[model samples]
Target: MTWKLGLYALAATVAAAPALAQDAKTLAIVVKGLDNPFFEQINLGCQKWLADNPGSEYECLYTGPASSADEAGEVQIVDDLISAGVAAIAISPSNAPAMANRIRQMAPSLPIMTIDADFLEADRDLRKTYLGTDNYLMGVKMAEEAAKLKPEGGSVCLQLGNVAADNINARAQGFRDTASGEKGIERLTGQKGWTEVEGCPVFTNDQADLANQQMSDVFTANPDLDAFILIGGWAQFAPQAYAQVTDQVMDKLKSKDLIIIAGDTLPPQTQAFRDGRSHAQVGQRPFEMGLRAPDVMLQLLKGETVEDPLYTGLDVCNQDDPGFCKDN
Candidate 1:
């Protein structure tokens, strides 16, 4: 499978960083967390790419923090990779702004490329290119799904992951914009049925226990909650988290009084969709993101230019239209 990046003229000269050895090139991929199945697939994709392209003169070094919210740890990992003289870096930032600043501090010296997530608008120049799903469109699809489930005006709550992540924020805003425009859907805000537990909506930190507790609290507080638009499939990641909500609201789910729509159809999330626990899953190609990053980085290292803000693609899966759901 050949991956083609749209070519462009180089704007600035990118100096190759000092490599570990002259014969082999070392590339680093820093994702949100290895614990997440999505990121695990990404890591596997990178491994597969390396295996397929054995003669490409590149070796991949993959690592990430234990938790998604460990911004400092992620920064340290990047610093360590830089110190080790990695030729290029592909990162899915936990915090976009911080990662962008860090990249800026090390720019030109070390070419940075983003995958899965992206940097902010003002700091986008720090990175060579971004390859991931259209997050805003993902949110728009979530909103459209919610409207489909409840055609006659119902309330919906959004479950989000890290608040500072550019992807999360974009998806949330997209959902809000599209859902607000729908006359039948009312996006709940404030502390009534749709409220934040601590300071924000279920910031799961990619932990199943935290996702379970946060979801249970929301379910307990909002018995009248018509639909849930989960921007991140944190609860579906682990059985314990899945049970936390399923055990509490199994009857409601069976009755079709409440609908749950989420993002990312990993094995567990796909099974949930199959079993009718979740109505739909928004699928993002994280594997492709990983597969393409090294290729893109290699191009940059060789003083070749590619298009900025490259989009992978997205799809919505359900019992009715199980598009990539069956593949999972």
Candidate 2:
């Protein structure tokens, strides 16, 4: 109508346009420890989802402890991304509860998705959904397989990457619960929670090496250890070291005698399982975590409901049966 009113309207529209553009901007993925294949799977998933959605893009930033035990490292990474002003953050948290308040403080409205390890506290406010394996079930799967390998389970040792991680903790719980449920199995005390966070041991770039050494030390210390269940990446190295040490101790003992059942089938782990150096493993579809996590985040951003608390299916890799144990 009036020239003054028209000018005001034009300025208002221009101001609103930038806000809208900012709303349509790409996402940010902040993960813990880029060094691990597990996080690599999440990266792959996020990138593939962004590629499929032509207009949307993503920026991925990773930080974590020198070892798998460092949960704090993951929280610091989330903080860094918030400072950088990200749209959304997809993380496989080392410590879900510990990182919750920090992320909430940083980006309260920013859509957060947890892959692999999860945080229930974050679900109430800061985060939208979690995508990963049913870690407790994964633990149960490991124990169930351990039973098959050693019907009379004597001593089971757990070698997990990060004890602070809820997922790893849940899996460990599941393993212990399942093992206890069984009539014959007796859980051992070789489970050492290692991480890259503060206070945890430092071997981030060299987790495989640490895993190898740890396994060597565990078996060497306890000759009575009947079964070994090492979850996550350390599972890969456990058998190699077990093979080496066990071979040195008793040449007649086959690798199967120890009843090794590990979790999260990476390339190395899958290869090891396939080669029969290890017994069986619980495989988390990590690639799918990377692929599906972004979609879940997008859904949350659009105010859509995600059916599963944990997305991305999981399965057991039983080397005894070649099909279940194959690599992705």
Pairs of colliding residues, candidate 1? none
**TM-scores, each model vs. reference:** 0.86, 0.76
Q: What tens digits encode model 1's per-residue C-alpha lDDT throughout 47-113?
A: 6666656566787767999877688789878878887788899989998888777777765457888
lDDT of 2: 0.60
Give the C-alpha miss distance for residue 196 in model 2, angstroms: 25
Regions of candidate 2 where Cα sits further than 4 Å from its true position: 1-24, 57-70, 120-125, 182-206, 235-255, 324-328
In terms of lDDT, the best-performing candidate is: 1
Segments in model 1 whose C-alpha atoms lie over 4 Å from true places: 1-23, 182-200
lDDT of 1 at 158: 72
Provide the overall lDDT of each model, using Cα atoms, as 2-decimal numbers.
Answer: 0.75, 0.60
Q: Compose the digit string of candidate 2's lDDT tens values, residues 1-328.
A: 1112222333444343222233454455555565565665555555445445554444333345454555677677668767876667777676666788787676777777777767764354666777778887887888788777766556656776654577776777677767666422334333222111122221223266677676667667766666666766553644566456445435323556565676766666667766556677677776666666666666777888877576566666675575555633
